[model samples]
Target: MSPSFCVCRVRVSTGHCTRCARCASSASRCTRLPDPELERGVRAAHVLRRLGSDFVVFAEPHLKASNMKNLLQKDEKKEEPEQTVPCDHKTASRCLLNLMPVVSETVSGTLLNGTFLPDICLEVVHDRELSKLPFAKSNLTVVLFADISGDAIFCIWKADDKSTLADTIQTVVDCSLNIQKNYGEWPTCIGVTLRVKIGIATGMLEYHFFNDDFDNVHYSASGTVVEYVRNAEMLCTAGDIILTTEAWNFLEQKGVHTRYTYTALPEDMVKVLCFDPSVTEEEKVSFTSAFAGVRPALYALNFEDAPLLKRFISPVVVNIKTQEELIFLSEMRHVTIVFICMPEFIDIDLATLSQLYRIISAALKETDGVLNKVITFDKGCSFLAVFGLPGYKGKNETCNALMCCNKLVHEISAMNM
Candidate 1:
């Protein structure tokens, strides 16, 4: 990577910062925001973010690094003077996925060359792993599906956890393929060589409500130029551990060595990195053991949807672990939960309920805020929304809640149904 001259990273106005390639300014001056006392009431400018060589906004609209004052005032006339209690029952869970055989029967009805992993089951397993990861880590989940029965077990490190941990799951897989010559008939009973194909990838984990039911959600990973792990598993023979470029890069960053470039794709298509087990048993033993007590798991990906209800909200009331912990967290941060409900949902037929769901979804969108966790009960339809999330800090939580609730109500009322 050669250096270029564009280095003007200072803001001259709201939501806009300028970067000049031929800049000769001091480093400290370039990164600081314009003092609000000196530069106020400026026009809103386009947000600029650099991606690779060029700066652009790709998908989700991210606000510029600045505080936003609540413009929605309580003095405004309200059709409904009272507010309903927000849905604060449930929370998110952060855990590393065991990635065990959660769906053997569903994916392996017919064995194909000792490999029968279906895509749906693959995603379901990914979702299960994602539910355990905590917030604060990059919410990126990478799945490396082992060719042996489509099982996966990776490790993760919380952003706050500093202790070193081993990915025992990877070691177990490495050990299973080594017991062939241990004088045990386990391999003979299995009737086949236990080879594991490991593929690693980094991608976006996206979700949408399943059949308009927030309780049931579908999650999928989309990696950019790093989805080779899925394809690499098909070409590699069993007992082979193949790592994608993405995974190898991560390992390189972590200073974990147990890998060598085994070979290249037919025409240099993609580089194949592997922890060659064919090396002497001593080396293989050192290889797997070399990774123990490493900070952050090599295969761990954190699935962070902060506030738990950032996308699909679950119904299980999250029992706060301890009252003191809850009180401490509340004191440190503040968020207003909003629950949207349709009072007549219970009496309606399925057909009518479907129509009502569409109406409510549209109303939520008009609020310009995310619908965190949504709950549909027998009595009515409800959504749980938090005003101020962990990383995202707005000026006023109450104003945000009021504005969101008002916008949703106004949209629903205008629907004429």
Candidate 2:
């Protein structure tokens, strides 16, 4: 009744797919043949069996699986005309617009040729991973393009925004994990594994344009940075998130700690080291325990829109408020805990207090030499600020904490002025 196609019984990792049969696959995951003979044989066998014929049927050859279905349903965003990649023969172009929605603009107030160049670019190379196409439409990733005409997929991001960068990375990682998690849920997954090669690079990059005029734009990324990202992607193993040195350095400087070493990539490449984001579970548990799945359920009635929830896990940095929470962090010693209590005599209103507290918390996050996590608390008339918790041992941790403290003081003073 449905479209009949043989789901190739082949294992897949990255772009490499094991052949169910040489003739069955050239570059595709699996090819189905018009088995009129098999179909006729089966029908005839059914008739024979009804007539009590002993003729047996080998079910193996006929029971092939189907490919993943299209999941990129234009979510209920009808108010905004269902935007799509242009497919034109006249004045229009074939470029995939809106992938990196926030393409950089020049000082001249004109959009550059294709789109504004963003700070970070991530390429996802996948085979039998067609399901992830839906996530590409999730707004976090600018779905550049994906086609059987091309070898893999291209997704870009505006990496300079620290929160955007973190969210983008988290989304991409979630995509990879979901692909694997939901693998066996579909019939086709038994025949293939969704393998992904992720290459993340950061720099002043303008993901160029591909239009009807530039017929040659589809060959591959021509720019040096783009080429380097592609090369890094190729070097990635299955499900690896490899970052170029520049990108890795930028994140590391921001206090994202991961145990990595330098590996001189090929001359044709761009990064000094290939840093992998897939750290051990033990390594992640320490900091992640602080907020893993700890967020409260958000609803449309309570929040503005879904995009608002995109704020990265850096919620107002404050420790949990219970005795258990305090005990949990009690053993965390030598930590620079600075308590900024407003002078007891000066009564601060709740509204003003909230604003000042957030400003101070943000200062800690933005301060250089400060580590990633800065736990803060709103203990009534005064606020408690703590730094140098586990996972952050920067030699200048205390000094940086003091810097944040001074920044907080200056900002609060300016606020009053």
Candidate 3:
């Protein structure tokens, strides 16, 4: 079973309450007492009935139905601004100046501390300019993490396909450099000092999407490679592509080293090497093997056939309808983050999964919450929701988060699947 929990200041388990002082205050709001055996029986019956009938018919109508809007709460407060407040772009930029570093430290503390297998991973760092780039494809899996103000995007390429790992690495590098070069040419970006940090690491990852609806697709990756590449990107300097030792070694082994010019970093600065003993001796043999590197500009990089890369770029930017929306996302504000995990979600049917996504998205929209990120792995899926961000009903963030979670739990339970 998934360990259901809520995060205010700290994690508070909703299913099994420890009743510690910190979580005790919110205990009543967080806890959900559902009979597991009964839930399983009902869910099994529902699945069996749907399987007996044409489930597609049931799923299709609900997906296109206008009644999904009715699921949202009607009585939203009118006082809050419907649009993002106008602020100097410079001021907005400063609000997020310290954002990336803080995000990197948190990721390091949580996900990157584990040991794992090495595989090639690439990152493209960009400001809002590269938002619409199609980076997802069949062989590539995109995982998105929303760090309140921005997203931490990672793309992992599956090795089972015909394309060589070298192809994956080079393509990502080429595309990233191309993006940076284009941004450099933009008149507004010339003196602004905006930089994109693309990090590449070689490590293990796994992913699969529930359906073909790419717009509604919630694709994510799991395992060490995701963490490794994320850390690599976060540690990277602006305007440079950083590579973990594993990625570097893989490239050299493939004899693709001559294509790009790269300088190795000092041993102390090579963070991937310091991780648990997964680092092989040969991978550490050369000082010039792994580090920040520059590549020749490829102005005409095309995405016509790169579906995996397209997936990588999808969730990084979505649903931004205005410049005000962009500015709003840039502002730093205290918000409550609610993380929802369904450990046994792998057993749920794809139709149900899609339905769940829509339900959650609509719930957050109605409650003045932002559905920040959705992470799917082999066993289950998790969602990140934020409350009290600008351009929404800004009052009572913590209360809103709890109420939304509670509502979701009940609504999802009623789905009985």
Q: Pick the candidate with the highest lDDT.
A: 3
Kindly list the per-residue Cα lDDT of model 1 for residues 1-417, writing each as its tens digit: 110111111112111111110011111111222232101101000000000001011111122111112211231322323222221112100001111222221111211100111122223333554353211112334433444333222211111121111232233223323321221121323344333444444443322223243432322122331234456555655445454554444545555435334454562223344345544542232111111111111112123312222222221112222222211111112344556666554333334434444544444344333334332322344444444433333455456557655655665666555
Best by TM-score: 3
Candidate 3 lDDT, tens digit per residue, 261-368? 567776312322221233232111111211111100111122331233233221222222222222222222345778788887744444555577677877776677
lDDT of each: 0.29, 0.29, 0.37
TM-score of model number 3: 0.39
Instruction: Point out where model 1 deviates above 4 Å.
Output: 1-138, 149-194, 203-218, 249-261, 267-417
Error of 1 at 127 (Å): 16
* Clash count in backbone of candidate 3: 13
Model 1, global lDDT: 0.29
Return the TM-score for each candidate structure.
0.27, 0.26, 0.39
Please, what are the lDDT tens digits per residue for candidate 2 over residues 1-417?
011111112122111011111111121122221122212222222222222211121211111111101112221312323212211111111111111122112101111110111111111111222223212211222121111112333444434355555444443333333322322122222353234445555433322211111111110121234444555665666545455665555445655434333454553322223234564541111111111011111100121221111111122112222222111211212335455555431333334543554565567555422211111111223443444333332455567667776777677767752
